[model samples]
Target: MKVYISGLYSGTSPQPGIGLSRSLRIAYPDATLVGVEYSNRSSGIHWLGFDELWLQRPWEELDLPAYGQLITELLDGGALWISGTDLEALWLASVFPDGHANLLSPPAVGLSRITKPGVEAHKGLPLQIPPFVSTDHSDWDLHAFCRKHDWRVWLKGPYYEAVRTKSWDQFEAVRSALAKVWSTQRLFLQAHVSGYEESVMLAAYKGELLGCVSMRKRELTEDGKTWAGDVTEVPEAFAASLREIIRDINWSGGAELEMIKDPEGQRWLLEWNPRFPAWVHGATIAGCNLPAMLVEAATGIPAEKTTAQSEEFTRVVLEVPVRARYPLPPLPEPYAG
Candidate 1:
């Protein structure tokens, strides 16, 4: 099948798109692969061994019409389009609302449903949701909310994006920083949840779970603080419970479940990421290549059999690499020729 992979950039290496491309080449040696780069730097070309490569200016600068037209062109030619970047996926979901039919259903449904609130209101279910009070000001009550929750709560964006804080003063400081860029009224608050974090990455088709892997966080960082951690497979019972949850939600494509372990040793739902997780590279190394699985799901091919072995004691580190660029000294002022 013809597959198109888009969203390439110079700083995209920390993501698993390139690694996914390499894995796809190994798995489907004969299938045609197309790579599209969205930047002028063109660093992705060196890694994505594709049958064809297309480079365009970054998406932000492109006119909506041009961007839509380009996407249509690519879709018209390829049987499957794997968005190698989150922005591309969001763009597709917005511009070509029905275009995701080419993909499996779960992820598409999750994206469409969770992008906005009020569709489903919290009914006070026993789910581990942090108590939140909304205010007109994006920065309103952030400190009070944390204080009410005993100096710990999660600061959430309109969506599930979370920022954890330990004190009302710290929470207020975060709100101040965000207020510089975003209106405080746009910010919301949630009670902070304290527990071990675990994630389940899975592929589903027609509400049936096809493949899944559970991982515990080996490390976590927020606000410049980092903690070391490890990932292990979810026990069979927990996996089954999470699968049922996915099925109940009528989820269809690629998705993940974030959970926390309470002091009682029970798993509590943390949040659901309708798309790929940030640490997808870890899943790739653990024998589940999410991008390839997504491609297979899009094309109606069964996901490759994944070994159910956990790389226990396997330590992984997420590091930010910084590089300094030196500029050339300006040439001598023009000498009269």
Candidate 2:
């Protein structure tokens, strides 16, 4: 069987594609693993392990119909897709509104309710989502928010990335940068809760929680992404919440629930990422290979009760030679010569 994994970029700010591919390779040794990337320059393309690599046009260049057509073409012959980026996963959910058997992603209807802002307003989930205000709100005040949170708040995009700002100046600079890069002024502010950062990686299928692993960040990068972490016991309350969330949304495929456990021992729900975390390979190394479990669920293989066996896992940078088969990004006209 052929499996396609997207979002293969790996850099200082990494994507999950390389890690997910690694996990899948370990589980399905003989399966044809295809690394699908939108940009030609995605470094992971040359990192090895894939049986085949495909480069497509960037997402910005594709409209809805074109995107749908591309997906249909890619899924020909019933290839299973595991998207490694939130944007692609979200769009894939929409493309398969009624749900396609081969697509491993959350349902489209549920996606709307789990966006960064939507999660804060969602009810019946037994978790405290930090209070936030959208920049688009008529009465939005960053200064007031900063003062309330002791000048320590997380400036977040509606869909991706969060910057912890301890002052208004920092907030303004990051906000400006995000606005320019994302081409939108809409963003949100979440109150910063001082605590230990943790994530619960789960594999679910149509409301059933298949397997899960809990991790506490032992190390973090400048952007707050997991660099190293330790396997921890999954809290019963957290598991119950995951069940409720999965049932409420009929969630399918892989998900990461980020939370901050404050000094008082209360877990504050940060956000629910629709796809697996970049550190997913860490979970695989720890013995709970979620990407493989997702494949098993989709392929009718009996589920395995996988758990983390290794206590901890850490990341290190690797430099590899790019194969000549992969195309490089085009240079500017003046530099082309």
Q: Compared with the true structure, what per-residue lDDT tens digits does model 2 show for residues 157-241?
A: 8777888888777888998988986689899888888899988888877767777889999999987878999976577876777
Q: What TM-score fits each model?
A: 0.69, 0.88
Q: How would you encode candidate 1's per-residue C-alpha lDDT over 118-169 as one tens digit per residue? A: 2231122233543565534444454556567886666655544466768667
Task: Give residue 244's lDDT in candidate 1 (0 to 100).
Answer: 71
RMSD of each: 6.4, 3.2
Model 1, residue 5: distance off in Å is: 3.5
User: How many Å off is the CA of 47 in candidate 2?
Assistant: 1.8
Give the runs in model 2 whose Cα sits over 4 Å from its true position.
Answer: 118-126, 138-140, 166-170, 176-185, 302-309, 327-337
Best by lDDT: 2
